[model samples]
Every structure is written in C-alpha cells, then in structure tokens.
Target: MHEAEEAESLLDAGLRALFAADLPVGLALLDRELRYVVLNPALAAFNGVSSEQARGRSVAEVLPEAFPTLEPRLRAVLDEGAELRNFQVQIEVPSRPGELSEWEASYLPVRGADGAVLGVLVQAVNVTAQRRADHAMRRSEAHLRQVLDSLFAFVGVLDADGVLVEANRAPLEAAGIRAEDVLGKPFWDTYWWSHDAELQAWLREAVQRARGGESVRRDLLVRMKDDSRMTIDFMLAPLRNEAGEVVQLVPSAIDVSDRVSSEARFRSVFETAPDGLALVDPQGRLSLVNRSLARLFGYTEAELLGRPVADLVGEGDRARHEGLMRSFLRAPEARAMAGKRHVVGRRGDGSPVQIEVALNPVPSAEDPLVLITVSDIGERLRAQAQIQAALHEKTVLLQEVHHRVKNNLQIIASLLSLQSRHADAGTQAALRDSQRRVMAMALTHQLLYELNDFSALELGPYLRRLTQLLHDTFARQGQSVELRIDAPEQGLRIDLQQAVPCALMVNELLTNCFKHAFPDGRGGRVHLRAACTPQRRVQLELQDNGVGLPPGVRPGQGGSLGFQLLPLLADQLEAEFTLFEGPGTRIAFEFPLPPVEESGHA
Candidate 1:
C-alpha cells in the first residue's frame, strides 16, 4: 500500500470506469491466450452479446465473425509487444444478411507494473457510412470530368486570383497545347494567349472585375501555338459562395473567326463595286456611296453622304422623285427601268445627263434601306443619233444612183429594139438577146432603189417579182407559161454581193425553160425553191418539164451562153451544183449563208 501502488490502483479504477461508459465506439481487453477478458456494453452490443456473456471467453466465442482477423493482431501485441493502429476490418453477422459493415480497429499491448506484456486493448469505429460517402464523391468527380470535356466551347475553372485549375478538352485541342501547359498556371500566361503582353494585362483587368462581383465579356483575339489568331466571344463569370463572395471565376469562349471574316468581306464588296452604287436610308438620305458613284455625279463621297437623294435629280423632277422614294420606303421591293426610258441625273456642275437606275431594298433591323444602281446612258444616245443621220444620207445617195442607172439601161434597151427592126434576121436575134440581158440588169437596180436597205435584199419578194416580169416579157410567145416559188414562212434575205449573182442565175434558168421547154405553142410549169438549213447553208432547187433538157446537153456543157454561165455563177458562190437527167430537168445548188451584219445598228 505504498504511494505508487495506490496511484496504480486509482488509475486502473478510472480506466475501468471509462471503458464501461456508454459510447458509440466499442472497447475490449484480451488475455495472453487471445481470449476476451473484459468488454464494455457497446462492444457486447456490437458482438450481439451481453457484457457478462463476453467476459473470460475466447475472442472466437465472443465475436466469431471478427476472430480470424483479430487473432493475428492480438498475438503480435501479446508476443512482441507491438502496437497496431487503425487496421481496417469488415464485420458481418447472421442478423444482417448479405451486408458487410466496415470498422477501423486499433490494437495496443497493455503493460503491467514491471513493464511486462499482459494483454491487448482494442478500439474500433464503424466507418461503413463514411467509406460509402467517399466512394460516391469519387464517382461524381469522374462524371463532372466527362460532362466538361464533352463541350466544344472552351471552358475553364479559375481561382479568384486568375489561376487556372481545370480546363475542358476544347481549348487544349484548338491551340494544340497540352493540359500541363495550362492547368495550375495564370490564365493570361497560357500558350493560347501569352504572346501579347497588352492582351494579358487586359485579361487581368477583366479577371479583377469578375473578382469584384461583376461579369466580364469581351471579344478577344487569342493566338494558337502555330501563331494563328482566332476571334473569340470570351466571357468570365463569378461563382459566389453562400456569403455572396466570389470564390471562383469560370471562363468560357466560342470561336467567331468565320463570322468576323465574313463581315469584313461584305464591307469590302460594298465599297468596291464597279457600278455607281448608293445606299439610301428610309429618310431619303444617302447613307453610303462608292467611289464610282462619287465620280459619276462629279462630287466627293463626303459631299454626297448624308445628303438628300433629291439633290441628284433634275430641279423639275425633284419633288416627284422624293415622293416616289418615300412611297417605296414604306414597303420596298426590286424595281428596274429600261435604259430606253430616259431619266435625267443632275450633276454637281448643275448639268443634266441621261441615266438609268435600279432600286432594290435590303432587309434591315430598324429602318429600311434601298440599294441604288445608276448607269449613265448619255454616250449611247448620242451614238445612236449619229448612226441614224449617217444612214439617212447614205440612203439618199443610193436612191439617186439607182434612178440614173435604171433610166440609162431602159434607153439602151429601147435603142436595141429600134435597131432590131432594121437589121437582118441573125443580127436581129443577137440584138434581142442583148436587150433582154440589159433589161435584167435594169430590173435589179429598180428593186434595190425601192427596198433601200443596201446591205441585204429580201430574196423571196425580189425573186417572185423578177419572175413575174420575165413571164410577162415572154407572154407574147405564150400566155400558158407558169411560174412558182417555194420559200420559208419568213422570207429569206441575202447580202447584195450574193443577191446579184443569184438574180442572174435565176433569170437564165427561167428564160431557158420558157424559150425551149415547150416550143410550138406548148406550155408548162417552172419550179423555184429557196431554203436556209439549220447548219447555216443556203440551198436553191429549180426544175422544169422542159423536154428532158435536150438529150446530151448537160448544165455546164451546153453551147449556149446561159448554159455556160451557170457553172461560173456557182463557182463565184463557192457552191456545189448538180443537174439530174429526168422527164423534167432538176438543178440544185448549196452554199454557206453569209453571217448577219451587226455593226451600224440604228
């Protein structure tokens, strides 16, 4: 009963009292034989037994489900005097089927007065709920990573100091950078935008503004690893805690490079159009005009911009033009006017010139706008007037020439007729042929004088009239001689160079058919055809039932002047001529048609 023994006894009683108290944690003491010598009420409850039933029994009998794991730890503490701290254990019992309870247990060797190992003291805590919560937190973190990485927009999480903590996949991929190059670094110092020091300073200001409880949004040009820049709609939003203080800054951005480039291109086209283009606002004022418009009106662009559109119209038409402009602004659509319908544009020098205009309305946000395209037609009108005057003068000259020539030829034919009356029979026949040839030339000049289109002759009408004249000239020989012409619905036209040769050939063919085909007062029909093929070739076919062309007298081999002239005319036209022998004579020729004249249009 010395002082030290008394202190020991006091300490032991206090330890026993503390262990017996009602607590959530279980406490137990085991003997050197790995048997439970003492256990509190909580330990007994955890083992599904009473405290009295747990004392002086082996650990196996008290807690059969926990004994296998506890025996080794107890043996170490008893034999080697070692201490086990916080060893995790899974507890199961029959009452809670298919459920495992987790516990953290600590085994410490208890010492006696002589420092000898006596038994092991065990302390355990039920950690099943805490372990489940930790596992759920890990799953939620992985799910959040999945959601953030799936977005195409650049998204990042930053601390209030503008230090990047987490970033999604897009920013890293766009800049061709690795996550290690951005994460945990200051946002402005990242490879996506670190090249520009001024931009970085501006970004820092935006971060400060976000930290001060305000959102910051801006258009930023961020450079990539390859030195390519991109326009981005960048935003930084503050995330506040329950106390309404900003704890984090969330930065997000979307690439707007294409939109920016498109706007630039559209602006360039508006300013550089070739025509005199102007944009008029709903108030009838010119909002914009290109360089062409300024030059056309003899005014600087600054002088025209913001000016009323009525200023460009003639003084007499200003009121009417302004009224129409206002009316169009109400509900505008596309409008066009032909250049033939002339309008006057008052230049800056106060002179008027012919102009053509088209107005088209563009869709707008608030006020309506019209696009005006102006074209000056002054030179075109002047050129047309000059052409008309020159053509009239040429017409008069041609008519005078034709009139004199026709009169002279008629006089020659008259002379021939008078001389034939006095000459011998053979000489009279020669004089008569000369008269007929001169008469044909006179007829061509008469047709040209009447039509007056010197460039081309209407072949259908001209041929029909010529044949009629020829038939009448030979009517004294026989009244039963017939003439027929086949042509297209629209009469064919040929240039004068082509028409002259064609007329001569036609006259010879018809004359021969009439003079020899039906002799002795006999009569027959003669056919003439003219056609233009789709491939731009002209074809003429003439035939007659004229005694089968007087056997052995082919087209080019005939001894008569008319027969000899046929091949010469065909060669002049670069044509292919064929004569077929039959009950009726068939003659056909084809030549390429001349191209239509396009110059000197009036």
Candidate 2:
C-alpha cells in the first residue's frame, strides 16, 4: 500500500509537469469513469470552474450542456482505446450561460503498463473567431459578385492557368454565350475572339503576359452577337496574392467602335471638303487648312502653315476681324456670320475678295480650336444686303423674348411674396415655398438672359447663390448656420432642362435643413459639395451637423412638402438619393452627367 501511494503521487507529479509548458490549448486528464483526474489552468478556465471543483468530477457534472456530445467521445476513447483528432463541438460555459462558443477538441486514450485504458487526455482550441471570419469572407465575395454584375463594361476573371473562371453580365451578352460556355474554358476559346484566328492568338499572348506579371493593353476588333463588328480597347491586368504572386488575371474590354467610326468620317469630310476650311489654334495661328483654303488664298499648304489668320484678312477689315477672332477663340461656339456681314480677304497677290465666314469652336472641351469656314459671298453679298436687315430684326426679337420671359417670372415671384404677407402662418409658409420655387426658375431664366447661352447653365455659382438666398430668407432669431459650398473651381455645366430642377433640389435640401435641423436657436454647419467624376458622373452631397433626422424618417417616406418635392426633383435629374443618418444628416446623389446636346440656332 505504501508503494502504491508513492506511485500515485509520482503519476500526479508527472501530469502536472506535462501541462507546465505555456500554450493556449486547454489540457485535461480523466479516469476510466470519465471523471476529471487533473485539470490545468487553461482547461479550468475553459470550463469556467476552479481546478479543485473540477477534480474528481465527471464531465457531465461539470459541463452539462457539452456532456451530451462530450460524453460519447470520452467513452469511446476509454472503451475502444481510440484517439479522436480535431473533433469540433459547441459548449456554453457556466460563467457565460446561454452563449454558445465553438471549440476544436482532441481526445486520446491514456493507457497503463498493461495496455488497458486508464483515462482520456483532452486538448481543446477555440476557433470561433476564425469561423466568423470565414463566414464574413463569403458574404464579402457575394457582394463583390453583385457589384461586378451591375457594371456595364465587359469583364472576365481567369485563373493562373488562363482558364476563364467568372465573367460579368456584359461579357456574356457581348459574346452571346452562357456562363457554362465560357467558364472553365481557355480564355482565347471564348466566342469574343474565337471567330478570328489572329485575334485569338493575340489574346492568348496577352493572357500569358498577364500571368507572367505584366499588364497588356491592345485594341482588337471583335464581332458582337448582333453581327456588328466592334473595335474594343482590351486590357489584361494581373491580380496578385499576399505573396505578390500573380494568382489571377483580370481582363476588361470597352467598345470604342462608334468613336472610331465618327473620327474616320470627320477626317474624310475635313480632307475632301470643297469649301475653304481652316482650323485656327488657340494661339491665333492656323494649325490645319484644307487644299481649298490654300488655293483660295493663293498659297501652298506649306507656305500658309502657322500664319496668323489675321494675315489673310484685308487691310480694311484686319484689325476688327482679328479682335472678333480673339473673342470667338475665347468662348467659341458654332456661330454663323452675324447679320450676314462680309469680310474682305487678301490673297497672296494682295487682291481682295468678299467672303462670308462662319466661326465655330471644336466640339471637344479640351481642344480649343476654332474652325473658320469661308464662303465666298462676293457675288451674293449685294443681293442679300436687304435680307440682312430682316435677319437683324429677328435677332432683336429673340433677345426681347428672353428678357420678357425673365421679367414675367420675376413678377410672379414678387406677387407670391406680396400675398404671403397677408395670409395665416401655414398659408404664409406655403406661399413662401411657392415663391422660392418661382425664384429658382426665375434665377435660371435670369442667367439665360444674361449669358445668352440658352442651352446650358453653370450650376456651381447658381447653387451657391441659391443657398445664400435660402439662408438669408429662413435664418431665424439667435440661430447661426454657416453654409459652405465645396466644389471644383471649374463649375458643372448643366443643360437648361436639368438646371431648374437641380436648382430646386438644392433649394429644397437647404430649406429643409434650415427649417428643421436647427430648432430653438441651435447653430451648426451645413456643407453643399458638388463635383463631376472622371467617369462623367455628377455627385452632390448635402450635409448638415444639427439635430439628426427622426428615428425612422427616411427620404421617400417623409410627409412634408420638402420631402415630397425633393425626391420628385431628384427623379427629374435621373439621380438616386441616399440618406445617411448620424450626428448629422447627409443626403448624397450621383447621376450620369447629361450628354452634350447638339443644337442649332433656334
């Protein structure tokens, strides 16, 4: 009996020494009866009990919630002398009841010298955070796929082996194929390039280059599903892993076929036109002149190149025409000869000829080139002199119409303001809202009358002024709010169709913030940010740091007039509004900038 007691003490010492090494894993030892013989600090903490309480206690008694699953595994280790590796189980600790946490457990049978199972040794590792991370990663990947599917450009993803793994909706539509037809296939074999052998080879080379960690860009002609041939700007880029290895290839294609065709047509017209055509650079020098222009001025193309356009004007009209040319270059647009007037042109021989010139700026905003179209009105000038008087009368009438429209709108605004004074408070507010709406439209017309560019308006200054007007009108006693405008120095150009609605939207947003945001003389800051993205999308952000919105009041759900009109006006601009609630309220909207409209004199 003395020897047996000494051996038992030695076994306990050995078990304690075995668990002494510092590690995060929970360690425990149990007897054949599935009772805890030893529990280390880690294991004791895992069970939310003291080691003394766990000692000699059965697994079911200590952890009832985990015993249903744990008892079977513990019994198996004892009965079959088997070891279970990396078995996962969920358990609730007594210290934190009802909170289920996952743990990876390993069980091994402990044997005596006679090869009989004495107990089971258990090791457990917590994996709850890792499991949560895996779930979140799956959700993020699904979100990424949704975003890719919504894009308009053709996009495809290829594995390291250059096999197409996934593609967006546009690529499937462009190739006239389903997902199964392209996925898992070699990228070059897709319908987009398979029709052309040379194109297929080029794409294969590009894919290899991308896999080799070099990006490749090339223009390729592809036949679309509609049987229309399109020139696409194709690009392949390498997607790298954390180790900086190219793990995938991302390929994108944009159709530039229409732009190419348009450019070709313009080139043909510019070169083969019968009339004298000259493109004057921003520096007042001729950059390009057609053969007809050179012949009309009695000089070879080389001789006339780089000559100031004023050099070709006759002595009598030189100074005035040069000044007119400067003004046209400054703010150039398509304009015919004002009043059908004629300018005298001097040839290389010093002889003069009467010419009717039409000046227009190149349509591109970046390239400031003036196109001078010269028509020899020498013969028709005398016959059209009487018609010129009538044309002048029409010009004056159009200007008068614009001025009268602006005045009439202003009159309506003034009448609304006057009527609001005599009404009750609610009616006064309604009338005032109507007055502001009228003023927004009136301001747009006022700008049109002043600018004479009836087609579009500069939205940046217009928004600033409108906000200032709103602040001045609605600011109450003892409340101070700073209205700040954050926009690019170059203002956004909005067409007349969208200008009024955009102004009204700004007005509504500002008015809403002024009325409701600051209550009982509270002061804060309001910011109006407007900018145009490189993708030609307009972004508008109106933020105010004041009392946040009501708990559940959303944009389209509010009952006030401002809320009703705000969404309606945003719809008119084709913009989607999103509301962000916080210590303040932020309303943001982004929409594609309206395409530049091609128009003529109305």
The C-alpha TM-scores of every prediction are 0.58, 0.39
Stretches of candidate 2 off by over 4 Å are 1-375, 379-398, 476-478, 489-491, 597-602
Candidate 1 residue lDDT tens string, 439-533? 77787788788978766667778778778878887897555877788876354667667777787788778878877787887778889998988
Highest lDDT scorer: 2
Q: What are the lDDT scores of the predictions, listed in order?
A: 0.82, 0.83
lDDT of 2 by residue, 67-140 (tens): 89778888889899889999888888674578888889899998888999999999987566446767999999
Error of 2 at 551 (Å): 2.0
CA shift of 67, model 2, Å: 99
Clashes of each: 0, 0
The window of 10 residues in a row where model 1 has the poorest summed lDDT is 333-342
